[model samples]
Target: MTAAAVACTGLAYAFGDTRAVDGLDLTVAEGEVFGLLGPNGAGKTTAIRCITTLLPVPSGMVAVFGQDAAGDRMAVRRLLGYVPQQLSADQNLTGRENVALFARVFDVPRRERAERVAQALGAVDLTDAADRLAGTYSGGMVRRLELAQALVSAPRLLILDEPTIGLDPIARTSVWEHITAVREATGMTVLVTTHYMDEADQYCDRVALMHRGRIRALGTPTELRKGLGTRRGAAPTDPLPSLEDVFRDVAGSGLDDSSGDFRDVRSTRRTAQRVG
Candidate 1:
């Protein structure tokens, strides 16, 4: 296996008295897709923030491409591309304009910025919309634009947080296909956090399932499926249960509710809040 592109050891975070990410240890191999699978408020975002230098890791270690996140944040940032959970680009700007902005932030050479912007938009199949205002794009198209902006820096490590959220089935599928194509073409290390079991099963080389601020399980989709004994009682005539079944079985039945609730489990000084 290739060396680790990103590594976190005993990483923890908090809000108020709650522990949002409790001693999380993770590793992502070079050029591989590593998926972080979890329900809402499972600290997936918190962990991503720490790794991407959005939040401080007060008591643990996070490294990107052998650069320490705590001590060498600028160096780490230079090697990473981030697609935040929330929309990040200006609504008034054109798709190409957004890419250009990111290219500049990432310090792509002035002479090459235009070419880089074009390449990024092309990768996400947004070349046709490059000159169009971003506010005119659909949710999926906006997502593609966000992805293009992230890639404009040509980062080696790409971090996507709930990338396909709120997208329709067709749009989600298209986004996943584009993600797969991008990874295959660039050999970039990808770390994605998603609530979708199918996405984790289909696209992730390895997955870590998190629950209530801790990692509950880690394995490839097939390995995890087999480990759950889903195939044990299946006959030649019987079809296997989906990965969602394994996820529910291993991660617990508590996640089965559709309450649409959000939890604030951080241990920071801020008061905890919830959304529904």
Candidate 2:
């Protein structure tokens, strides 16, 4: 049955004095590929850290699989798997060994760990290179190995932050292929943050566009495109505008500005309500 995999309300984080994620709210449903899309330095990573409980929210609620992240972090972690933007594997270890290490740490049953490791590797199509040292593999294969490690625990909620960044086009496609295949085979809930609009549109059941620490839009790809309104009628309408165009039109080429105008508005409302 589908469930709320992650929920965050009024989440805020700051670095020094600059607010990173300001009063952010988000929700991801189970058995769906939910994508978080934003420009660079738009608090996407910060928001992810809060939901994954890597960083404290300081001013909001973060839950995973119905468990309060702050109060039940261990329980929350058990049901969640994270693939960070950076690779985190031992260079010396073989692909199979890296997955094995994670399985051991997560305490996957010994008898099942081997089979699970093999299955995960196979899912990523890395079984052929399973025994090769991770350092020997290409960037694409390294990503696949990391994905295999994430899947070893059979987690209910998978969080991926820029899982295919910096890869060549062919490698990027390979990674996406494996991700779609694995998610389909396992029926897992995935929360992905991606800068690639096409990938997000292709794979995600729904997407949320974040700008300057707030959700600017949330809908299916088709809905977001339609919300862009029709271009000046030149013959038949184009039917759908590209997400890139929608982003530009919505933000007016200032998506990079982090002035926190939205946060200030939210704070003013809160204060007025409190006074009233």
Candidate 3:
């Protein structure tokens, strides 16, 4: 069998007394799109941070393409490209310059940096606005610029944390189209976290629904929907359950106090306002 592109066993993380991620076990095969989903503060972002080696935890294990995220951070980093929930592109820099910075940071051979940066920008259809400062771009353009920055390294695994939080539906569709195009062309594994159930159903090969720092359910979208319908004792002739229905069933409603706190709400709102 082929080694998984990403693997996490009993992965746990804490912030002081608060345990963000608790004993997560996950795997993503190479060349597939996997969704890690949950309501706010469900440990999805923290888990992604741990997987990306941004945060250090005392227990559990995380690996990227068979490389230990803890023991071999650099090796794991080399194989991954990450876009965080918060903004990453510098507002003062042009779209092209933003991608160039990533190429430099990733040490993409100085000689090929120019071509690689251009390719990354073009991949996201940002070539025309490449010279414009990121601050001046629309929310969708900014998100695409960030995507280009992540692509500058040509990673084997792309991890995105709410990559399209504030965009309109059309913008969201455009972003996903670019992502799908890249995945098709490069066969890179994509692990993404999003609140958009429709996007997950449309793009993810598999999804893990998390709540209270654990996976409540995991399966293909159709399977999960059907499973929920069955659990609700729906007859075969009943309409299928929506992914949102499954989300509520697993997470105990987005209003569940355990889902998130005021700070989480503030942060998500702030991000939305910025990108809106």
Candidate 4:
């Protein structure tokens, strides 16, 4: 069998007195789109950071394509591409330039840089805007530019943390379209974290619902909703459960009441309306 694209076993991380990720275990298969869903402070970002080599992997607990992230940092980095929660492109740089910079950072040979840059831009449908300053692009376009930058390295695994955090429905859909398209073309594995349960239901081959620094549940969207069985105090005539229902069943009550939690609810509602 092919080795897992990403594997985390007994992984844990902490900041001072706070434990961010605790004994987390997950496996994402090659060429699969996997969603990591959780509320604020659920250790989703901490896990992503460890998988992407941003933060130190506690001992040898995290591995990318069988290369230990802590022991083989450079080898692991070569096979991974990451787009963080925040925007990474410089406002002064043109879309092409931003992607070109990543090509250099990824150590693409000089002979192949130009073609690789063009292919990356074309993959995300950014070729038309290649010469335009990233500052002038729409929010969705900027996200696409970031996607192109990540693609320049031709990574086997793409790690995205809240890639569509602040965009409107249309923009969010647009960003995902390019992502799905590229995945279909290249068969790259995607590991993404999002609060939008609706998106996870639609795009993810499998999902893990994380809470309190651990994976509370893991399965396909259909399997999870089915596992929910029935809602509390609901009439027999009530509609079947949605992924939202599954989320609420598993992680809703455990979620901390915070501004970020409120924002995530608002975002999920918007995405639901769009998907509906």
Off by over 4 Å in 3: 256-265
Better candidate by TM-score, 3 or 4? 3
Per-candidate local distance difference test: 0.82, 0.81, 0.90, 0.85
Query: CA RMSD for every model?
Result: 4.9, 9.1, 1.4, 4.5
| Collision pairs in model 2 | none
**Which has the higher TM-score value, candidate number 2 or candidate number 3?**
3
Tens digit per residue, CA lDDT, model 1, 115-171: 999999999999998999988888888888888999989899999987887777887
In candidate 2 the C-alpha lDDT for residue 107 amounts to 83
Which of candidates 2 and 4 reaches a greater lDDT? Answer: 4
lDDT of 3 by residue, 14-124 (tens): 776677788999989899999999988898888888899998756988888899989988898899899887788899999999999999999899999999999999999
TM-score to true structure, per model: 0.89, 0.88, 0.96, 0.90
**Model 3 lDDT, residue 123, Cα:** 95
Best candidate, TM-score: 3
Off by over 4 Å in 4: 230-238, 257-276
Worst 10 residues of 1 by lDDT: 267-276
Q: CA shift at 246, candidate 3, in angstroms?
A: 0.4
